[model samples]
Target: MKTTITVNGEARALDLDTRVTLLDALREHLGLKGSKKGCDHGQCGACTVLVNGVRINACLSLAVMHDGDEVTTIEGIGTEAALHPLQQAFLTQDAFQCGYCTPGQICSAVGMLQEAAQNWPSQATEDLTAAIALTDAEIRERMSGNICRCSAYPQILAAIRDVAGEPA
Candidate 1:
């Protein structure tokens, strides 16, 4: 299958097998290794990437399904020269220990923030009609899909709170 996906703000044209996953395409073909294949299943959020501003597990998605879509990997969110606020916060807070899940955590955080800004309610939300309060519970519920094996939840929460304008 010939697919063209706009990755990291650049159009990448590739002829890939129909079974090629978006994760494989990004990591193997495009050389974007930031998105890791943790569980190789949707159970782990390590393959999370932003597709059309929404986060999904890249390992669970086919590359052909994302043709003509704008995909943002960790590389797209920010660079070493100018880190994204979440990236910088993660650093300042030491949110990652093994660092295997940091990329997905950051990407998921970006999409999760956008979702919260749009008044999307999570299971922890007490009031569906009101603006999100972004309480600790709310943050935890919203980010439940991403798991850090190193158990850096506290620091991760601090990083997210810092980016969300909440006191750590």
Candidate 2:
């Protein structure tokens, strides 16, 4: 299958097998290794990436499915010279222990923040009509999909809160 996906602001034309997952395409084909393949299944949000500004598990999605779509991996979120706010917050808060899940965590956080900004409510939301508060519960609920095996939830929460402009 021939697929052209604009990844990290660059259009990449790849000739991949239909079975090639987005994760494999990014890591093996395009040499973008930030998005990890922790479980290969969608259960672990280790392969989360933004597709057209929406987050999805790249491991579970086929590369061909993303034809003509815009994808954003952790690399696209920020560069080494200039870290994304979330990335900086994660560092300031010491959010990761092993650092293996940091890429997915940051990518998911970017999408999660955008979703909250758009007034998207999570299960923690008390009032659907009210503005999103990004409360601790809200952040936890919204980020529940991405798990940190090191149990760095506190730091992760703090990092997210810092980025969300909430007092930690």
Candidate 3:
């Protein structure tokens, strides 16, 4: 089947099987390999990407379903010369050890910030205050899906808090 999806602000047209996951389509078909294939079951979140400014596991979604949706991968965030705020914070904080999950972590953080900015309430948000205060628990809960085998949770949370402009 022929499918066309906008990826990283580019219109990608391809003929693919119905079973092709978005991760494979991005890495194999469109040559956008930033989204990793960690668990291939949506458990690892290594294939995390943004669709319409929301984070999702690419391995659990089909490519053809995102025909007109805007998908943003790690490459779309920033370049080596100009890194996004979250990216810069991650680098400055030394968030990752092995660096395998860095791309997904960065992308997830970008989407997470947007989600936070939108005042999306979480389970722990008992009081719908004027503005949501980014707490360490909130960050951890929001990023629970993205696992880090290196156990770099402290640095990752620090980086996110820094980008979020919240005192830790």
Candidate 4:
């Protein structure tokens, strides 16, 4: 099947197998290998990417299904000269240890920040009607999906909070 999707602000057209996972499409087809294949399962969140402005497990989605959609991988977020705030925060906070999951974590944090801006509620939000504060608990809850096997939760939370304009 022929699939065309905008990736990293560029249009990428490729002939792909119908069952090709989005992660594979990005890494293999488009040669955008920042999104890693950790467990090859959605549970790990190592292949998380922003599709249509929402964070999703790229490993769980098919490339053909996202035709014409906008996708942002870690490479799309920022460059080395001008790092995204979250990326910079991650560096300053030393949020990553092994660094295998940093890309996913940064991508997830990008989408998570958008979610928070829209007042999206997470499991930690007690009052659904109230604005969700970027509390430590809230950050943890929202970031639960992106697991860091290095157990860098404290630094990760600090980086996220820093980008969120909260006291780190």
- Steric clashes per prediction: 0, 0, 0, 0
TM-score of every model? 0.98, 0.98, 0.96, 0.98
lDDT of each residue in 1-168, candidate 1, tens digit only: 999999999999999999999999999999999999999989879999999999999999999999999999999987889999999999999999999999999999999999999999999999889998888899999999999999999999999999998543
lDDT (Cα atoms) of all candidates against the true structure: 0.95, 0.94, 0.90, 0.93
Q: Give lDDT for model 1.
A: 0.95
Name the TM-score of candidate 1: 0.98
What does the lDDT read for residue 115 in candidate 1?
A: 96
Q: Which regions in candidate 1 have their CA more than 4 angstroms from the true location?
A: none
lDDT accuracy of residue 158 in candidate 1 = 93
RMSD of each: 0.8, 0.8, 1.1, 0.8
Candidate 3 lDDT (Cα, whole model)? Answer: 0.90
**Which candidate number maximizes lDDT?**
1
Error of 1 at 83 (Å): 0.7
lDDT of 4 by residue, 87-131 (tens): 999999999999999999999999999999999999999999998
